[model samples]
Target chain A: MIVAAMLTLAVGTYLIRLAGPLLRTRITFPPGAERLLDVSAVVLLTALVAVTALTEGGGPADAARPAGVLVAGVLAWRKAPFMAIVLAAAATTALLRLL
Target chain B: MLVCLAVGATAVSYGAISVASGLPFWFPVVMGTLVLAGSSEFLFVGIVGAGGSPVAAVLAGLLVNSRHLPYGLALPDVLGGGWRRWLGVHIMNDESVVFALTRKDPARSYWECGIGVLLCWPLGALLGAALGSAVSDPNDFGLDAMFPAVILALILPQLRDAKARRPALLGAVIALVCVPLLPVGLPLLASLGALAVVPFLDRTTVEQGQA
Candidate 1:
């Protein structure tokens, strides 16, 4: 089932990519749906971040992990570089776990 | 180029992360080869790693990647002709598009896409997955937390406006509420339901913040 699902997505994504060349001129996504698409990436990603930070195995994540995420969030909010952000989050959690 | 290194880094991390999450070896490699798009590929692995339904993962991936549809429209003429068209569509990616759009030349876009894809995917998949398997401990670096943090940092700047933030907040809340109820990937998929509200959302507000 997992393999099939992956393949299904792979095919669907390929087609979407292909849609450019084949239906380029005739294509026009509805304005509202397009807006929805614009926001959905942020939406889904935020949800992933939220869930990952707050919950684990249907419950809240361990304190250290969330704390680490919090620190990372602060840096992210401040626009830290990519490496700095990842390192800060991981280091916080690692240090916390050690205590 | 700086872009190649960045792409390679993300790809390797993606491969390592997927392996750490218990994905089969072939999963990351094949996903890199087949999906080629890094963001959606990571999302797919994350969803599946967390025991999310593959069906939901596929849909969510397709949803995020639908952005490519616009890329196609933006450069209908950029795509190659004949058999190359089939291969050309496969290599279309963020970097290539960004590069292509700079000059708006068809041949240049095609070549840039090819070069970007060729350099980024395989190196990341092979080396990253190998590194992932070699590491004795993924938790040592708190890598599990690191993945989401990395992704969040990337997307954080995009939500600066209320127009974008509101929908994202809606989706985040919906997904959180569903976390205990739905399977891994479904909550994320459910978050996309926030989009249904868009027909009523002032497109100007949303579109205004956009480039």
Candidate 2:
């Protein structure tokens, strides 16, 4: 099931990528639909960040986890390097848990 | 270029983090090779690793990747024609698209960065998987928080656009509210409701943002 799911996602994404080059001349997405697509990426990713950072086992995760993620967000907003953000976020959370 | 190294780094984290999340060791490597989109792969690992249904993971991945459709429309020339186009479209990604837009030769830049990320991502995943398998408890290293942090960092650029920010903030609130009420995956799905509010947003400013 996992393999099948991965394949389905891969193929579907490839098709979406292909649709533009192949169908650009023949088809056009309505402006409203285009806007929806644009917003969907941010909307879904924000939810992912929220859930993964804030909730676990259907409740809020330990405060340390969210605090670590909050620090990561500030660094990212400040344009820190990706590796630094990852390392610092992990370290912050680990150190907090130890305390 | 440096983009390849950044891509590889993220793949390493994805590999290690997904494994730490209890996915099979091989999953990240294969998905990195096949899907080759960082955000969607992360979404898949994040959702499926959390015990969400495979259907939900795939749905989330597709929606996140739908932006590629517009990217494709803009890059037909870079894709070339004939059999090469297949590989071209496969390599289309956020990094490649940015390089294609900014570089002197769109086709060359597209292929170089796209193929560069393509090679590094899966290889990095394999290496991270080896490291991840040795760890007994991911949370001990706080690896569990890495996924969300990486995702937050990736989307930070998008959120700078006020047009994107409003919907994203609303969607996040909706998802959080649904967290206690819905099952694991459904809240993310329910977050789609925030997009409905987009039509009512000021389209003129949004058009400028897109431009």
Candidate 3:
């Protein structure tokens, strides 16, 4: 099952990734949808962040992880460097787990 | 180099966790190369580890990865044609997509992806798999926390733009509401549904008579 799923996803994902290069010239978004496309990355990424941070294995995330993400989110908002952001978040969570 | 390492970190940790979770040793190495998708691979492992159906895993992965469509449109110049195009698209992921879009050059994308795919990602996974027993419970080292933290930090810069504020906030709200009700990735996908309201939102000009 795992191998089959991996192969299916690998193939399907390749096609999905290729769709951009292949369809670039063929289909264009209408004006209204085009505007949405502009901000779609932000909206979708933000939504993804919420899911990744706040949930785990299809359910609510545990306390330590969400708290860690909160710390990271604040540092990110303050424009901390990437390394610092990851380092601090892991530290915070690891420390929390110890406590 | 930095980007390559950054992309590899999550894969390494995920590989470690997957192996710790009893996935075969070659799982990450094979999946890392064949799939070359960071987030979906993580999601796939998470689902499969939980004994979910393989078809469901692939479906969830597709929905999560559909964002690549817009990414392709964002970088239409990705591949000219031929086998190179296949190889190029196969390496497409969040990092390469963002790199391509920001640089406005597919060559840079290919270069960075070469760094991530050809060098860092698979090797990281292999190393993690090799050390699987030593790194049991990735969460103890905060590997679990790090994944979302890293992703959120990378995308945080985009929110500095004032125009992104509303759609981002509303999308968060929509997705959060759906989290409890929907399946794993569907909430995030439904968040895109919030885009439909973009045309109607904050349209003071459209509501001229309201004043």
* lDDT by residue for model 1 (B27-76), tens: 88887878777767878888888998888788878876775665555443
Query: Candidate 2 or 3, higher TM-score?
Result: 3
lDDT per model vs. reference:
0.72, 0.80, 0.75
Model 3: how far is A9 from its true place, Å? 1.6
lDDT of 1 by residue, A1-99 (tens): 877887888899899887755664465668755555556656766777888787886787888888888888899899877678877888998888888
Q: What TM-score would every model get versus the actual structure? A: 0.62, 0.64, 0.85
lDDT of 2 by residue, B120-194 (tens): 999888878888856445577676677688668767887888778899899999999998997556777678798
User: What does candidate 3's lDDT look like per residue over A13-37, in tens digits?
Assistant: 8888888667766777687666676
True contacts kept of each: 0.73, 0.81, 0.77
lDDT of 3 at B88: 77
Question: Global CA lDDT of candidate 3, please?
Answer: 0.75
Each candidate structure's count of clashing pairs: 0, 0, 0
Q: Could you give candidate 3's per-residue lDDT for residues B74-139 as a string of tens digits?
A: 553656577777777777766665555444465766556555655678888888888887876667
Clashing pairs in 1: none
State which candidate, 1 or 2, has the greater TM-score: 2
